[model samples]
Target: MRWSALLNPGFLVAFVVLTVSAIGMSAAIRAYGLHLQKLEIHAPGNRQLSALPRETPSWKQIGTDQIMDEDTVKTLGTENYVSRVYIQKNPPAGQEPIALEFHAAYYTGGIDTVPHVPERCMVGGGWLQTKGAQTLALEDVDTSTWIVDAAASGGARGEVYSVRTLPAPYSDAPGTRVRLPFGVAPDKPIHMRISAFGDPKTGKTLYSGYFFIANGGTAASAEQVRTLAFNLTSDYAYYLKVQFSSAGVSSAQELAELSSSLLGELIAEIMRCVPDWTLVESGEYPPDNPRRRTGASN
Candidate 1:
């Protein structure tokens, strides 16, 4: 009688429903496990990551500056980040002054992990974003231009010890660095035109441009970053936010162009110092890589 009651159609149906529901819930929890482990997310040490070179032939690095105070860093809620403010001077007369602020942070929380972006930070600092955000891609760059003469002069005989020894550009000439016109593509990087209204009587029009790179993917909009943030396949997450401002630009268009060129050059130099996403993702440092040690360009 008890066996018959257990095997009744209604009881069997109810048991099946409960079993399926339990299995579905367990799968859902496993799929969204990253969300549960967000609080435990921690980035590797800043020293473990790659760094920018202090000097380049076209641009001389004056010195490094801090992007934020301790208070600000704490407010951002990540200690595994690096901030570098570089004052660089272009040669010929060293007159073209360029200032770059590069801040890279690792966060494993939801898409809203990064609280500071150009839109929020600029407005909070009393600057107004006049132009809508746009995308810019730094592609097909003539990488030969990045290779310094010193490395090229050594020829292919000896092992080059400098990180400044850039990968050969796609050209017929193998050893020589080629000079080409810097071109801008319309994609990827997020750029915004910003202005500040000081005392109305003496208002100042300052220009600002910024972008964010998540893992290795570039996002031109905050929405894009948020959408890309939920990657359960990867164990860790990282983002790089680069911001710079130039004063006395004639127009937002001019500022955008200049910002693109400067940032492209800076990024090229930076790549030499930082490890690739593959290495970072695996949390494994390459052995005998000069860039990993001393953070020097060479």
Candidate 2:
């Protein structure tokens, strides 16, 4: 073809039309494929953790009206989020009571929607993070089995035992190894931190542990959250951020121990009520599935 002929208006229009049509067709195909796969792009209801027993032999729920203020809730994305606060009951006479705060958010977009990392939030509030975010290796126990066994036996409900101890300073030390529970191990969750606002002498100190759960599993890092959200074979896209904090903790080691114990129990409680990923993936509720009974309790 001659160069002048190729530059004709009609020829250029035809070329542009073909290019646009090809791109449009490609996009349409992708969209249709996603639809066929039945990807879950929104928060799923009836998946929130049930109201933990109001009064257990070991701990009693302290009635609290609010977990986060309206502004904080709005900042965390109010589309799908739940928060609860509880206190440890009947501790040794002199020990300060331990307080637990749990917050979970199902972000459809991605991990970026989750907000208020302790490092940032503490600093923003004029509190200094004495220890930066670090991965504390937690014991990998099959929590599903534990829940079933506990429920069946009517033993101490949600009692979890750890074979290993969490180290001090909350850092991934040389001998540290992360235990994989249920063959699902994500990035290491940041260990509870100790933060002080001003002069260490007079400032109040708080110990806190925070982590995220995605697709019925817990992850400690943003990268892990992305991994679960973007899994190709699974359409389960949800993130749950759980945080527990307390004051009057003596040392980081003590706080780490307390956090590990509380986290294990809390995860078990959450998994008991969270929707089963198998049913969610299939997009069908089988009458025989145990998750049907456990998922929508409250």
Best by lDDT: 2
Candidate 2 accuracy as lDDT:
0.49
lDDT of 2 by residue, 141-168 (tens): 2233232222112222122221122233
Model 1 over residues 1-298: C-alpha lDDT tens digits? 5888998999999999999999998899766543333222332233322244444434434445455678987887766555654455552374556554445554554545754666677666766666665444434333334432233233322221122233334212233322111111222233443333232334665555555555445555556655544454444444555555555465556556555554545454433323344343334444432334535221
RMSD of every prediction: 10.6, 11.0
The local distance difference test score of each candidate is 0.47, 0.49
TM-scores for candidates 1 onward, in order: 0.58, 0.61
TM-score of predicted structure 1: 0.58
Number of the predicted model whose TM-score against the real structure is largest: 2
Q: Candidate 2: worst 10 consecutive residues by lDDT?
A: 148-157
Model 2 regions lying over 4 Å from their true place: 1-50, 67-69, 79-84, 90-96, 109-112, 140-202, 232-236, 285-298
lDDT of 1 at 296: 29
